[model samples]
Target: MIQQGDAIPSVAVKLVNKSGVIDGDSATIFGDGRVILFTVPGAFTPTCHNNHLPGYVSAGEALRTKGVNRIICMTVNDHHVVSAWADASEALGVVEFIADGNATLTKALGLDKDMSGGGMGTRAIRSALVIKDGIVEAVFTEDQPGQVTSSGAPAIVEFLESMPS
Candidate 1:
């Protein structure tokens, strides 16, 4: 799995927004600032839609105040699904959504899980990463698929609060 000090992989991703979809590179997107990149198993899943994402939406301001230049929520779904989820969550302006349609980034970071048993096929494990200038500063991965313990927004806020200023 990716760890502190490892650089984000340079992979192509789709940036989905209300305007439309845009092709983007992971390295360029996360390379220049303090970023909070959180991943869900899949977009609009029960746990993800009800619990995980809402935390980040509510905590967006707190994270930004702590120097997060960007707040991103990524999933192993296509641009259309991600865009709809972003709209439903009402997080368009507050949280940016990225579509890892091919699970390229997930596999590259070693965070991919075979969710075929659940009929979801390959999916990203629930996790969060704090990166600065493209290098990982912290990694919080949930122990189980349904539980959001270490990778939740509150945990991230606490982690940032404990950082040396």
Candidate 2:
């Protein structure tokens, strides 16, 4: 998996917005800015729906106040699923959702998680990356699925608080 200070792969990701769809890459979307890229194994899953997504949504402003330019929630699901989940969660404006349908970026970063036995197929593991200017500043990943500790919004908030102002 990618580590702190590692330059994030400039992998292509389909960014879905209410306005329309746009082709984006990490180096560009997160370019010249501080960003929080949080990933969930699957959208609408119990833990992700109840905690991960909402946590970031609730902490969006605080994270930006601390210098984060964009906060994104991503998964290996398609755009339709992501859109519906975002709508359901009311996370439209607060957090952008990226559809990595093929787990392109996830695999590129070496964070792919196999859930095929569980019938979900390949997905990104639960992880978060604090990237500044396209370089990872901090990385947090949970060892077990359905557990959001180091990668939760509050944890990211604390991580930001610990950074030099």
Candidate 3:
């Protein structure tokens, strides 16, 4: 898995918003400035709906206050699904929803966790990364998919606060 200080993989990813969809390279996204990027297994899933996504949604401005240029949430879902989920979750403008349909960024970062045995197919491990200028500054991932201790918003916020200004 990609670790702290490693440069993010140069891969393409798609994101959807009220304005429509846009595609960009991962390096371009992270290399621009500081970003708080979080991944979910699927949109509207139990934990992701109630907590994971909501956490970042609520923390969006705060993260920005701490020097984060963007707050992004991604999943192995399509543009339509992700866009709808963001609208339904009230995270539309707060947290940018990205579609990692083929696990492109997930696999490149080595954070892809298999869920096919349970019929969910392949998905990203529930995790968060702090990237600055295309380099990973910190990574937070839980031991299990359902648990969110290490990977949750609070953990990420605290980590962000601790970074040198």
Candidate 4:
């Protein structure tokens, strides 16, 4: 898996917004400023829906207060599903949702967790990445799937606060 100080991959994907969708590369997404990007295995899953994304959504303003340029939520879901999930949860205004449908970015980062036995197929491990000026500043990946600790939003914010300014 990717670690702190490693540069992000050049995988391209689409961001789904209420108004429309924007195509972007991971590097370009974090180019202008610092970004806190979190990934879950899939969209609308129990842990993600009930806890992961909500934690980030609630911490949106606080993350921005700490100089985070964007709060992004990524999943191996299609654009329409991602859009519907964000809209249904009322998370459209708080978070920018990205559809990594092809798993190109996930594989490049070595975060492709296997869940074929459980029928989940290949998915991303729960992880949060802090990027500044297009480079990774920190990474908080759960030791395994089904765990939420440093990968959650509050912990990520604290991690960012602990970094040198």
What are the TM-scores, per candidate, against the unseen true structure? Answer: 0.97, 0.96, 0.95, 0.94
Report the C-alpha lDDT of model 3 over 1-165, residue by residue, as the tens digit: 999999988888887765668898888877879888898899999999998888888888888888888888889998888878888998877788779999988899998988999898889998999899999998888887588788888888898788777
| Best of the two (1, 2) by lDDT | 1
lDDT (10s digit) by residue, model 4, range 22-52 = 8988778777798888999989999999999
| Residue pairs that clash (backbone atoms under 3 angstroms), model 2 | none
Rank candidates by lDDT, best first: 1, 2, 3, 4
In model 3, pairs of residues that clash are: none
Shift in Å, residue 149, candidate 2? 0.8
Choose 1 or 3, whichever is better by lDDT. 1
Tell me the RMSD of model 1 versus the true structure: 0.9
In angstroms, the error of model 2 at 74 is 1.0
In candidate 1, what are the lDDT values of residues 1-165, reduced to their tens digit? 999999999999998765678899999999998999999998889999999899999999999999998888899999989989998999887788889988998899998999999999999999999999999999999887699879989999999999999
Put down candidate 2 lDDT per residue, 1-165, tens digits, no spaces.
Answer: 899878988988888766646788867887778989999998899999999999999999999899998898889998888888888999878899898999998898888988899999999999999999989999899988789999999999999999998
The prediction achieving the highest lDDT against the true structure is 1
C-alpha RMSD in Å of predicted model 2 compared with the true structure: 1.1
Please give the distance, in angstroms, between residue 32's alpha carbon in candidate 3 and its true position after superposition: 1.2
Provide the clash count, candidate 3. 0
lDDT of the structure predicted as candidate 1: 0.91
